[model samples]
Target chain A: MIGIKELRAGDSLPEVRLNPVTRLDLIKYAGASGDFNPIHTIDAEAEQAGLPGIIAHGMWTMGNLAKLFTPYLEQGFIREYAIRFRGMVFLGDVVTLKAVLKDLQDQELTFEVAAVNHDGQDVLKGSVVFSAELPDL
Target chain B: MLKDSIGKRSEKVRNTIERGAVRKFAEAIGDPAPIFIDEAAGAESVYKRNIAPPTFPVTFDAGVIPELDLPSKGLIHGEQIYTYVRPLLVGETVYCWMEVKDYYERSGKMGRMGFLVMTKYGENANGELLFTEERIVIISEAVRKGMGA
Candidate 1:
């Protein structure tokens, strides 16, 4: 139902607010991602690794963004999405997800996406590219 | 710290980013896209070859820099952005280096502290610049309540 033309530069997606990271979330993410770095779910282990405490997987945060774009790119519009880990996120931190249209081509659609924490820090900075043509159902 | 006699940047550490590692990443997230799995399907996509998910590049030999690490109760998932020079193939053996591109601090409700973390990556198997991914992250108390703390 969503079309690329509907999204334009400065258009904003519905705001996504997620629950704070809990030990359970980390455990679930570890089980799902199989990252089991120990630093993410184990408090002492994280400290030993020179980290403040248990942190969340970078992908988990990116997943929320993927979820946000799913409705628009549902059929096959999204070509790619990605991000690099800059800061470590620990249990209990709140992250805000947002996006803005950057450019659109008859061949592809693109936007700039970012995740900001409670402190107004841009936690994740990346782009999402989508196919301009709609897929046939 | 003493300067090296050769004056060359010491090989601090080499993070071997591999498919198996990325496979873990894809598995950790439960992404079953054919391109991420079936090599043939990826090759056929507009990207012209079997490619990992967009995030795949991050796991390919990512080198983390210090100071980007913030002291906190835990690391939080913040913002993520990716641009493509071309889609990555499943077994292309891509290599990358990560650096702390930027960092800053500010005052806020949690008592005057804010930070931004950024990293850039250069990719290749034969030393070619494929694409660059600059990731930015922020840390603050405002995140606590906003995330339902």
Candidate 2:
């Protein structure tokens, strides 16, 4: 867990390497998120839609990106999150999550975050603002 | 045209933040955070109860604006932003709705693309605002042609 006092701009958090993307994972995500888009689950549906195969939901990757802040939950909560879908995450592709503290002000820490696929391509990129109580100066 | 939906808003929908669904969502994302799943652990946390993950609101039914009439296929989720007032607690009832903030078109390698910008809102039972989700949905040329727009 990261403490508010220990946080500094430019410090990098521990990298999180997720298991390869799987069809079952997407199915579970579809059920949980209520986004039953077939392109994210059924191969036939994806092919019919002109995609090579099933793809992961953008929200799924965005949700997992929050895992990087799990340890810091005790210190603060995520106040804001924003991301742009840069590329597609295909089946069997492993994703890596990274975040670097970008700013610290008034108990809010801003982090530059990105999810990179196995090919070193960014599938998603964004920023997160975490709010915590800073020690009185 | 899609531009007419710029100020359109949808009917408000009520959603209950269920513990089971929260657990499932947390698990699906591969996050085994005890605060999200384990009740005993949650009781020990600062919030003093289980809390939903930041992205959990995606499960809520933010009512749709009919005029958008977006194509069902090949719609790409271009961007998303969520601003929260606080973490949503388990078992809480929140009302959600959506509004079309803007719309426009741009040409890219994929040909003409329509960018639909909308905001989804979640409020407490008392009608106090809690969070707002801003998203951009991209309708590609292929999807537009399919819709014959």
Candidate 3:
């Protein structure tokens, strides 16, 4: 488990690997999140939307990132985190998530985080801020 | 009759926020960077890995469906903030619990005033708490000529 004290500005978080994008993953996400946007499941819909191919849901990737810190951030230490959409993830694309500690305090922590795809492109860009003394997981 | 309409208009949906889907969203927004498509693209960056686009979770990670009975001119997305432990990647699955966190009704000079806050919680596949997002939207009655349509 990673503790906040172990991180520092310009410090990168551990790397996380993901499984291949599968139809089941998308279907399960649709059912679980209540977002029935056809573009997620149907290739025709995505093509109609002028996309290159079917894509995964944005939140799913974000969830994967959360899973990385599952052991550390079980409590209320994280205060605020937000990201801006910049790129896309094609089906079967293996994505990775990395974060650098931007700031730290006894009560709060901040980091500039990024998500990148296989070809050296940025899929998501944003900053996250969390409380330092958070609840235990 | 109204109850049924309400039920039909407002319904809870299960959503999964994944990485590949975030890439498509980037395409929709006119961004086709490989970082969103291929994992190796992230190798050079300090992050040392591929990551999903921020706010990509808004697509499937579940949120409360609002019932708009009033004839509003336009629904405008004002602002949004997401808090999370780490950045997201392509194949991760997360469950969404969405709801109307708050609402404000006010009377303006021209017509009625209203604002809505939609909140959603994204949980990992293991049912662990991931993060929360608050979406703010504004609604107002449209000004029409003669009798309002």
Candidate 4:
């Protein structure tokens, strides 16, 4: 993990990957999120709704992206963060989340983040605003 | 049917941020960030207590006075945007409010689809702001038709 001072404007954060989104993963999410939308939990219902079996909740992918920034969250100085869902994700799709330093101020840093699937299709994209003291630098 | 809610904002609903729920959320997202799950580590970390990941606001709803009584089925989550005031702390009570900000339509590969843009927020018990999550829900024509069923 790089310290805030070690990060350059174009530094890339280590990517987080989740392979083969499974049906059980969606079930756990449905339970944890309290979002029991059948499109995400039941395979047959998803097909009835014109989807390719059960789909991943958009928040699931976004939450994976947050995992990439979990180190920062541990230190507790994140000032702002936001994301936009750009594509759909289905069961069995491998997902990857990435981020790059966008800017740096006296004590703050911003980064553009993305989550993409196996075909390089976007699932989510967003940015975060964080300001914190250098801890291990 | 949702068009009627274009600018309707719901009354604020209050809820407490619980540590157990925060840990469940962390595990569900597969994020093992110590500050979000380990109280011991958190006690030594910056916040001195477990905190939630930025996207954890998805679980904080008591009930929204929905202005749009649209069909719940077949409505997909199109997009979501979250802006933070600071990281939310576990066991902190906060007030949440929601509103349908816009209603529009566009051509979809399937057919006509409606977009309902809604914004929700969390504020500390003292009335201080915490975070805002603006979400877009897409209702396909199939969903529109099923509303009467």
Candidate 5:
């Protein structure tokens, strides 16, 4: 996935979508991550806390977004990855991650990454700076 | 208030990035990539062993600021950023700690809100930085109303 091919700014990187989030997914994330926040696990607790339902952890969504670039990660190091939580993601929503090449210089490439929920509403928005270009391989 | 927590840092916590946690995290995220769970596949890769996910450092948080008293229930995660020197390799012991970087207030529809920024960093045993995670937690109007002091 290293930038073996010639790439230019403005080209959209491949878009990838993860499996629909499930109650068990959140539960597993909670266990693995030690973030037992009830708002992500217990549905009743979430509603009581004024949420539509159990929402996935923002880190969970950000991690899923990172998955989209896994193929290219080995090519270089992640210099920076940032995301703003823009919308709430409920269980059963499939997250689609899209990234576009924003710039390339000095062996570094900047990309704009976005994650959209099932309804096409943007759930997360951010940018990533990687040490190399994955030549679209 | 959150402002009082400024400049506070967590205790130096050390933990090993184990394979079991990596497997669970990969499975939980529905990532079927073999390198995440298969040692054979990992051995064949550049790292020569399983590597944790990019955001895996979040799990290694030392703890929240002790004095940063904000409403416990109505706090929302605002923005987050993770910058890595490299993907954390499994089986490496990392020293982790965090500190309150910034705290400020702003007006929103709900009313005045407080945003607290904390930066967490993980470094290998040799004292080389592995990754840095910056988190922003916001206390909403509902939080203040709930406190009602």
Candidate 6:
């Protein structure tokens, strides 16, 4: 668990390594997100679209990246999240999520984050800003 | 032309954040945080209610712009950014809409690719901004050719 008080700019959050991506996972995500893009679920459709095989929805990978902050919700909420898809995530690829605290100012803490595949290639890269205190609405 | 659609805004679509949908979204992402699924835990949390995950806004209906004319298949999600005023609470009704920010084409190793940049907004019933999501969708030359546009 992350202790917001003790966190420093150089600290890296505990890494989370997900199991191999599976078809069922994609299907569930597609249904939940209402992103019924066939390229993410049907192998034949992906091949027809010129892809090697069914690929994971970019949002699926992006959603899972938020897990890094799940254990520290009590401290604050994620105020900003930005990410760029650098490479494709295919079925059976294990993605590792990592984040390093980049700066802390007032109630906001920023971290540089990335998701890398089993082969050590970054599939996504970006930064997330966590607000340590919820401001008055 | 795709560039002509730049600055076009879509119609506002209203969405209710339901508990069941939130639960399903949490389950789909494999995040079983009690704050997201268990009522008791939520009651004890700082928010005093179950709050949706930061990425949960993806489920909202961001109204589309007809001018995009994107091919149904082969469109790639290239980038995404979310700026939140606060975490969305379950049971709140949000009005969602989108605007085409920009569009351009570039040549990459794979071939020619078109980048469509759009920003989606979510607001409360009172019309106060809740969050804004900016995304870049990539259209490959192949898909464009397939469309024969």
Best by lDDT, which number?
2
Candidate 4 accuracy as lDDT: 0.80
lDDT of 2 by residue, B1-149 (tens): 77778999999999999999999999999996998988998888888888899999999998888866787788899999999888888888999999999989998897889999999999998898888999999988777777767
RMSD vs true structure, all candidates: 8.7, 2.4, 11.5, 3.1, 3.1, 1.4
Candidate number achieving the greatest DockQ relative to the actual structure: 6
How close to the true structure is residue B54 of candidate 1, measured as C-alpha lDDT?
Answer: 56
RMSD of 1: 8.7
Over the stretch A2-83, how does candidate 5's per-residue lDDT look in tens digits?
A: 4612568898777887877888888888998888889999978999998989999988888888876677655665778999
CAPRI docking class of candidate 2 = medium
Q: What is the TM-score (0 to 1) of candidate 6?
A: 0.96
Q: Which stretches of candidate 6 lie over 4 Å from their true place?
A: none
Greater-DockQ candidate between 1 and 3: 1
Clash count for each candidate, listed in order shown: 30, 0, 50, 0, 7, 0
Q: Which 10 consecutive positions of candidate 6 chain B have the poorest summed lDDT?
A: B66-75
Using lDDT as the measure, name the better of candidate 1 and candidate 3: 3
Compared with the true structure, what per-residue lDDT tens digits does model 5 show for residues B1-149?
56667899877788888888888887766675776788898888777777787778877857656765556577899999988876777788989988999989899787888788999988877888878999998877667667652
Alpha carbon lDDT at A84, candidate 5: 96
Better-scoring candidate (DockQ), 2 or 3: 2
Better of 2 and 5 by lDDT: 2
TM-score of chain B of each: 0.63, 0.94, 0.65, 0.90, 0.90, 0.93
lDDT tens readout by residue for model 1, B34-138: 555555765566544444555554554464443233445444444555655655555565556665545455676656344444445555656665556555555
Local accuracy of candidate 4 as per-residue lDDT tens digits, A1-137: 66765799999888878878998888988899999989998878888887877889988888878777777664436566677777888878999889999998877888898898999988888787776652331
Give residue B104's lDDT in candidate 1 (0 to 100).
55
Which is superior by lDDT, 3 or 5?
5
Better of 4 and 5 by lDDT: 5
lDDT (10s digit) by residue, model 1, range A91-118? 7888888888888777676777877888
- In candidate 4, which residue pairs clash? none
* Model 6 lDDT on a 0 to 1 scale: 0.89
